[model samples]
Target chain A: MDDKLMLMIPGPTPVPERVLQAMAKHPIGHRSADFSAIFAEVTENLKWLHQTKNDLLILAGSGTAAMEAGIINFLSTGDKVLVGTNGKFGERWGKVCAAYNLDVQYITAEWGKPLDPNEFKQALEADTAKDIKAVIITHSETSTGVINDLPTINQYIKAHGALSIVDTVTSLGACSVPIDEWGLDVVASGSQKGYMIPPGLGFVSVSEKAWKAYETANLPKFYFDLGPYRKNAAKNTTPFTPAINLIFALHAALGMMKQEGLETLFARHDRLRSATRAAVKAMGLPLFGPDECASPAVTAVMPTGVEAEKIRSIMRKKFDIALAGGQDSLKGKIFRIGHLGFVTDRDLLTAIAALEATLQELGHTGATPGAGVAAAGEVLNR
Target chain B: MDDKLMLMIPGPTPVPERVLQAMAKHPIGHRSADFSAIFAEVTENLKWLHQTKNDLLILAGSGTAAMEAGIINFLSTGDKVLVGTNGKFGERWGKVCAAYNLDVQYITAEWGKPLDPNEFKQALEADTAKDIKAVIITHSETSTGVINDLPTINQYIKAHGALSIVDTVTSLGACSVPIDEWGLDVVASGSQKGYMIPPGLGFVSVSEKAWKAYETANLPKFYFDLGPYRKNAAKNTTPFTPAINLIFALHAALGMMKQEGLETLFARHDRLRSATRAAVKAMGLPLFGPDECASPAVTAVMPTGVEAEKIRSIMRKKFDIALAGGQDSLKGKIFRIGHLGFVTDRDLLTAIAALEATLQELGHTGATPGAGVAAAGEVLNR
Candidate 1:
């Protein structure tokens, strides 16, 4: 293990010192006026980060809780839903929905591939009764480092009259989600990924349609019930005790984001992605995702005949650089290098240089040690 | 809201700088060996903090998630369970169970009251077929600032061949839980409370009996399935991506706890509780819980006819001290002052002084200024 390795994984991404300072503060009373103010600011900031004016509820859980909350609160027993499956998170949505007894129709796509909008349209047309209550899709699938086309998917959901629940756990704060413009009903995100905070808090922004559904929907929930969360969230208090420290971190992270401005943040991510992608290509490695749909948050590299885990382990133990490996079925096929929030061009260069060394150590010929670093530097300079 | 108010809420106590620093450190790769080592340390430390050698799973949610995970994973829908509803957390157990469609039979006690062993026996007698899968109880209810008698309740669950799930959210590190020795089948706790960190992490330690039921029992779960958690927890990894930065805080917090020694930590809480209770009694104000069952974590003071929220607000805005007010049914009746983890005798004294000032500001002439503080000092000094 690299004792001083920097994390370039999708998330728990790098956190700024100020956010950590905010988290380190004493745990305030969740119901107290002080905390209520912090909570309110955080909720508002989360909405701002998503670029939406929807009522956002914070859950003291991982992004999965927000996803589960979106599912359980929207559907009752035997509800049918269409889940776009292309990566781990999308499959997880199906698994979570199945657990709730929801009849989920899986819309499959190959790993590192985007689901066709036409397929979704056909599926919706087939279900003339509109029995499908919600359309679940991931904005940025971290597993394959692919950004799905949400605007097209949401349009399809709109035509079909289904609630659109988008998992922006990796997209928010890293890329443009444009919650309102995209017509997303429910958008879920986590603090650790792009918000530059630790994990443990999940944010869900609910549109008016979803909020109205929350009022009447009953699926047996207390802690994760959206009704209480929505009602209490307006006043800047959670229905239950939140992870107060994380809220503080959120407050700090949002302040940092607000200062940087969303447009600048998006541009920064774009530049970093371009640089990383260029570096990988210069190293003569195959890129996992299509160039058009490649995620700015992370880049997936395919090294022929290489086990993804070994490369990641070597990156960690040798040069103290940590990267993410493929999940489930994609195991040993692709290794991901993240360039999300709090990541810099310098970080990208360091990762490429380390990868070059690790590749050489693994006897992968035809790769110059400095080629990747120089390519990354050129893009970063541009 | 006071800009620099000190929080005296139990569970979300003050965090030390080192813990915050640990949390603020740049994010690490969650899947890498470096993180795995940190994860392993936290898992081992959680076992130590929980005082159990059983299966311990760390979750990225509040104590409620841990509580829900234990119940939903071990009990199938329509299964019956006995819940002890002495305070808020116990009521939450009943609420969450009902949410999951559990046929819950709760032995109720008034808020601020503790459950009697005889009442538990009667509930067990009512379930003659041994149909009760588990008995859910709270070791410390943060709302009412009362500690339940876990030893007595566990004895009942054991005699009846039912698993015992204890919510130690506010009591785990503050007092002696002794999970294995006390016959607790499932023990749930959160980091913000006794672990002396900011919120966002819930932990559960499961015994053999709970695991056995978890294998066959079916309840809706995805983010909080104890099965996957148990399976992955063995390798110092969570089933899902955890609140990684919070784990960093937890590592620091647990390190501090270990340095203090569990015995010393418990004694500190005991001393603080004794001081606060003695001071409250010395002031001649009516206290909420029974004298014997008063939690060392917090002290609920009933200021009859003196509006609780008003005084709490004054305390926050003027004296820069934040205390907890009553919830829904108990609102305006009492205000709770917490003196749990990370709090010192000086902090208790400061809180007492602030309470006196707020009471005076609210025109409460019942108690003398500094009287409680002075009395508290005597107890703490002893």
Candidate 2:
């Protein structure tokens, strides 16, 4: 009833009405002939979106589940994994690995900063015996709104003979992530972010190299057994019963994505990111991440002397616009606005206007109310 | 655009319009104040729906994932578990346990039959050393439409000092399952079944005994960690980025269930099931399971010499209805019609009528068009 509620979080972007209708339809047979057609179409579209020819499998879980699947499926217990830790999701990889009793080596960059490709090369070179089985990194760290140089780093890992697992949860469709070209062994993604569908389905594009690790690796797994999933997926069915509604929704969203074209979608996100950053700069808010590595999905703004929580709360309660505040050590320090999937320039303008009003209410001001929208409009119109 | 499509499969039932709209809303902050409110409300309702005051945690995964979480969280590699295998899902539970390297012993019932309570008692009594850490059973076997007697079986497990894990994926909301009173240590459910939502979210309610086993579990788990999930859930947040859109839809569906009251919902399912059985009998079709053990969620019919696949295909193409064919060896011999979640008397009558036409076209049957509707309406009206 309240269409005014605007979500500017990192994911679960608003779905189109058509996609919702498709999902809302009566549940189909997960193993039926009709669903097989739909399943094949979705798989083809997913590979197209990822720019890969690898066997893409869908899991009826969150993006984190796919990430965990990548970990346990590729590495045995006590196996060493090189984790790139710059933001929340990267740290999660390390923590999950540690929890699973893996020997974890964590490489760090400051929060809101991207990891260097040369540093990655150094880490791999340091492991002369090739103890490190995989290098795990996030393409877009939603927490800090930073996009690392995945292509270069993945190349480094490939050259050193270590597998690369990339978390493309936030950047898959919004940016050009060429999975095959980047030599990523396993790329994990969720439906809610760039796919413009409801959350519930996660996908992993597994390279032949990753599949090789899967055969000999010894770790506990059942529901996410990539082996059975790949085997059954050839017939367009899951090893287990899937979230059938979400699959229907995925089919619809993929169709829409195909119609829009991936290149055009990436360009749209690019323009949106540029406009949002320009507006933030126009409002005199310092950007959280380095300019060269800012994420296209979300923008993190560091408002001087202003508590991010207060601004987020006011925008949410007063204008029904939900913005994300910082997590962990950065809480109440930086606020983030998402302009990802299904997000248009008009939505960005709406968020900017709400942010402006909320900022003024919180007693921080450097620009007029209309200046943010106008600056963003300049890029959007072009 | 075709609103008349009937869902007679076990899961991914027809979602309500309100729930669909809720899911279509843009993704919200996973940890924001508003998202917390939603998470809190969904948990509260789920607790009531599960009929337990235990620690109920939500995972952004399918029912199998929740089952895996229950297994790996409580059992070690060499631990012994008693799995009751009657149909597909039960065998799946055993396979997953085996994959986890657990020593599993099976007490199997023939397909279309419930597990004998005495069988479980004998198994436990035979193991005087209490080597069996847990006993797993499916409350309602989706593959066979058999509802096992849980309360008596759980009592047997309790007397033997072993915990009980029940898969109530298909029966949680369709029938009355007094989880805490029945001593169910862990109850796993999915959204696509009786919860009246789409697939993707799996819920597990853990008892004190199960929580105690968690302290000693040495298996590999990270994203499905109940410890972190329980701790973060106290603050109404998930440890990882949640499937936000599905949660929104779940909240809406749960709200609708609460308004109707659980007891009434259960009773309605029971009546509809009775009428459906009467209709099948009147058509001279033999039911798959025993009358006393038939699940309220769905009815599996053995249509004599008629082909299940052909009946299913005719129903889908001509009547726009989807019926579930049998799995494994029973395939093409039996068909299932689901009456769980969001089904009304009118829906049942419509499905039955279409089934009659399809069955007759396939050169089988002895019933008039209105006989099934009449049988169902009599019970509903009473």
Calculate DockQ per candidate and list them: 0.69, 0.60
Give me the runs in candidate 1 sitting further than 4 Å from their true place. Answer: A1-3, A305-310, A360-363, A367-369, B1-4, B304-314, B353-371
Model 2 CAPRI quality: medium
Report lDDT (Cα) of residue A143, candidate 1: 93
* Candidate 2, B70-108: lDDT as tens digits: 778988889999999999999999998899898999999
Q: Model 2, chain B: what is the TM-score?
A: 0.98
Off by over 4 Å in 2: A365-382, B1-3, B365-382
Q: Evaluate model 1: give its TM-score.
A: 0.94
Assign candidate 1 its CAPRI class. Answer: medium
Per-residue lDDT of B1-382 in model 1, one digit per residue for the tens? 5347687877578888788778777667676666799999988888887778998888888878888887888888899988988777788889898888889988888888888888998888777899998888888888898888789877877889998888888888888888878878988887777788877788888889888888888887888888888778777788787888888888998999999998899999999999888888766678988779988888898877578778887887788877887776888898888888889888888888777777777777777777888899999888
TM-score of each model, paired residue for residue: 0.94, 0.95
Best by DockQ: 1
